[model samples]
Target chain A: MPNGLDKPETTLEKIERMDRRIVFLAIAITIILPLIWPLGLPIGVSPQVDDFHEAIESIPDGSVVLFPNDYDPASKAELYPMTVAILHHFFKEDRNLKVIGLGLFPAGPPLLQKAFEEVAVDQYGAEYGKDFVNLGYKEGREIVMASMGESIPQTFPTDFFGTSIDSLPIMQGIKNYSDIAILVNVSAGYPGTKEWVQQVVSVFDVLMVSGTTGVSAPEYYPYYNSGQLAGMLEGLKGAAEYETLIEEQGIATSGMDAQSLGHLVIILFIIAGNVLFILNKRNKNRDRGGRF
Target chain B: MWELLGIWIQVFLTLAIFSFLYRDNPFYKFAEHLFVGVATGYWVVLQIRNVLIPNLFQPLFGEFSDPWLVIPLFLGLVLFMRLSDKYSYMSRWGMAAVVGIFSGLAIFGFGGGDLIIQIRSNVMPFIDTEAVQAFTQKAGVITFLNILSNPIFIIGVICVLFYFFFSTEHTGALGVVSKIGIYLLMISFGASYGNTVMARISLFIDRAQFGIVNWIPTVIIGILMIIAFVVLAITGKVDPKKQF
Candidate 1:
């Protein structure tokens, strides 16, 4: 193997010799720097995101929305922004909400509270048991989801902080999906948006919207096109775009600049990586008698 | 004072998790473990209050008590048998119940929502008056191509479904159609991959900005990291060839 300052190294030599730490550092910088000093780039809202916005927007005030936060902290980086944006839209539109969680992950309950509290502070003088209720996490994902759509209180008798559902103004007349206007699911993986669509939405004839991780987005496109899901927020980019729309409406727009620039920096890094890879391949092929 | 302390704890914990970007170390491990522990504890408490108490216990003992609750309660308890080797097989009943319920729900859901409804939605548009009216209005070179291509939509759907039909051999005209379907599927998959890469890269960019722009102190940390690597290399603590 040739050392640095010697003849160009073989691909195998580079792989064997390159420091793993360098790759780690590159990834770290690629993620962190843009977050700190954002470029505030423009992001066009996709039709999917717009559909999500319109679904929630079209629901009348005082209508019930069953929101399931089915993700943990690991996914917070991507899903949190979407949660905030959606909640802001919900609150701004004055919709009554019933929050439930399928105990897929432990962090889900508290994360839901934190996100709601962050957005609900300034809008509508929102009172806890009256405007919304957190039914907390339930076991048995499919069974619970199916039962809840049939009977809300049968699934959750009490709220998260130990309040009876009967006492909450929000639960007064909301019997099932028939009373509820829409089902908003902010999910990470299994027993998530897909499960909700299958077990609850399809059976009950409820409107459904989902915000899912990037990896899961493609799988859901068929459902989206079929009208099973009225709208979808696709990963962080979708979240960021949704955030932009919310902020433009004069809600939590303060963070848009930071989010936009972060996206631009990532796009630049991908371009740089591909360019370097192609150049290196060409140089190696030329030296190796035209063999790629 | 408590609020300030909480803020500090959160910030430090966030930084500790982020420190894994430099290298895997004790701080990162500690944060990871703590996160898992706290998260698990939170879920257990929530389940007791919302699920176990209300759905199972309340119905078993409270006003609306029913014998049906006992069945699920027993099954739920049997899941604990998983902890003992002798009783491990008992847990399968609970597992089978959950799997059976999920599978039934998934099949019904997919058939009603995805398969039937999707095909209906796509085909319904073609039969509508709007489509025919547009075809009639534009009856020229462009419109002729559009009208002629209408059948291709149904053909494309059939071809794509046929391409996945491993049970049958491709022969005659079906072979060419299936080949086209395979090409379309590949292009769609490639585009999806590009979207996924873009999403992951955005996450990477966000983290990079945090390390560099959040604090100037990271510069010194960066320098220390480089120096440590160089020293390890010089002192033979790390083999140059095995750096990865």
Candidate 2:
């Protein structure tokens, strides 16, 4: 070749610059195939999950469990199943629960209400304001939490359905964090389990556990190690494991096989892409007399 | 019937968004615009229903007995002053109040939770009996793991802190430890990245499940979309690459 530009591109170079559409297609296939006919891979229980389960199980029947649904539709795919599974466990144990939302502006409360309606009310025949109460979404994140820490009645005067707290049978003995046996925070992002820890649990000396997104999981490990969080569920895997513990094959369990297959596809792609990149670089170096 | 229609619309929208995998087109553009519009509208409705009516409206006029409710009601209204050019500065009062309260709260909240507790927790005993007891199920393997883990945590913390300690230049032993710190930092970062990748793929799997579980509606809408997209592509009415 007369010039570098005149030389024909190597196979590695061609592969390196290949259209990204093909990669997208491969990802699409990997996720879809497993869903259509699942591999049904076993989901091993983690020590963290075992701890979480034990913490909940240790609480006597009819103990008031504080559950904060702190996520939006964007994270519904990851966090929603966990919400249902936990509610199932709570109702199964006949635990008195209060579900609240201190999450995003609009999206959090309805999901909490829906979970209550489906799992607690319909499935378990839980009476409204007797078995569970939905306190709804409050505007201030940590501020609302801090206020609740001080006084639950002062922060939320009424439940989500516009019923005064005075009318609710569930709120009779519950005044603040002290009344709650355990605080279970299933969170997606900010003003979530971390915020709850900082604002309420540490202050009140309440036992707390969290189920957070996969990305937020590693960040909370220190808190878990420190005993700030008694236990935690990390993302969908956490949810699946929890579902397994409860012996209910819920949505999280259904998605686990697909999740495993998707991860495998991504790892394979990363390896293949790196190999091609290295080959292309070596070829270029050979052409340039090993200097460039 | 209405629920079925809603599901069909959802199916169409999902396909529309997914079509971008091929290339940018009008379908993707429509879906994108529709999502933003719907989301914004939904947010507005929820705020009014959940926040304003229940918190502000009911307390003020509807069977509310508290005089203290007026204070937050006034402050919340002050937050709306940003809409006016002349009164926008008044919004600062509301903003300042929020900042002041949170800052005061953070002194104890963030400081205690993140700093004090974290630091205290890291001061682990050189020999932890609880850890030893916890690992005793498989005595040999657990002992090895406990030994491996305890030192890594302590040493990693010390070295990483040293790496960040720029008051003095890293030299000799400090330099070597700092280099070790960098390795430890890389391992932590690699773990985080691997977990994040798993999370993202979980999201993809969810969307795929949605499509598969609702195959009939999704496939019907998808085929209709493909035909419409192809006709537009052939006619040069939509540029698949640059339509968005």
> Could you give the TM-score of chain B for each candidate, in order?
0.65, 0.86
Please list the C-alpha lDDT of all candidates, in the order they appear: 0.70, 0.82
Prediction-by-prediction clash tally? 18, 0
Q: Residue by residue across A1-292, what tens digits does model 2's lDDT show?
A: 3225558876777788777877888877877787778888999999898889888888877778888888887788788888898888887865554544334436877888888888888999988787788887777788888888778876787778778888888888778888888899988878788888998878998999999889888889998999999988999999999999999889899888878877888889899999988887777788878953
Please give each candidate's TM-score: 0.79, 0.93
Q: Which candidate leads the pack in DockQ?
A: 2
| Candidate 1, position B54, lDDT | 73
Off by over 4 Å in 1: A2-38, A93-105, A246-292, B1-23, B58-67, B81-92, B122-159, B167-179, B201-244
Worst 10 residues of 1 chain A by lDDT: A248-257
Candidate 1 residue A30 C-alpha distance from true site, Å: 5.5
lDDT, residue B10, candidate 1 = 58
Candidate 1 lDDT, A62-172, residue by residue in tens: 677788888876677677777877877777755554443323454577788776677775555666776666777767777778887788876777776667788887788
Model 2: clashing residue pairs? none
Q: How far is B176's C-alpha from truth in model 1 (Å)?
A: 5.0
lDDT of 1 by residue, B1-244 (tens): 8975564465556666766655565557788999889867877777677667777777788856677878887888899999999999999998899888888877887786666777776674444465567778876775665565546666677779889887778877778879988887897797678667655654544444444444444455556555765787698775545531
Looking at model 1, give its docking quality level.
acceptable
B43-152 in candidate 2: lDDT tens per residue?
A: 78877777777777877788666668788777878999999999999888888888999888878788978899999999986666766787675578757677567678
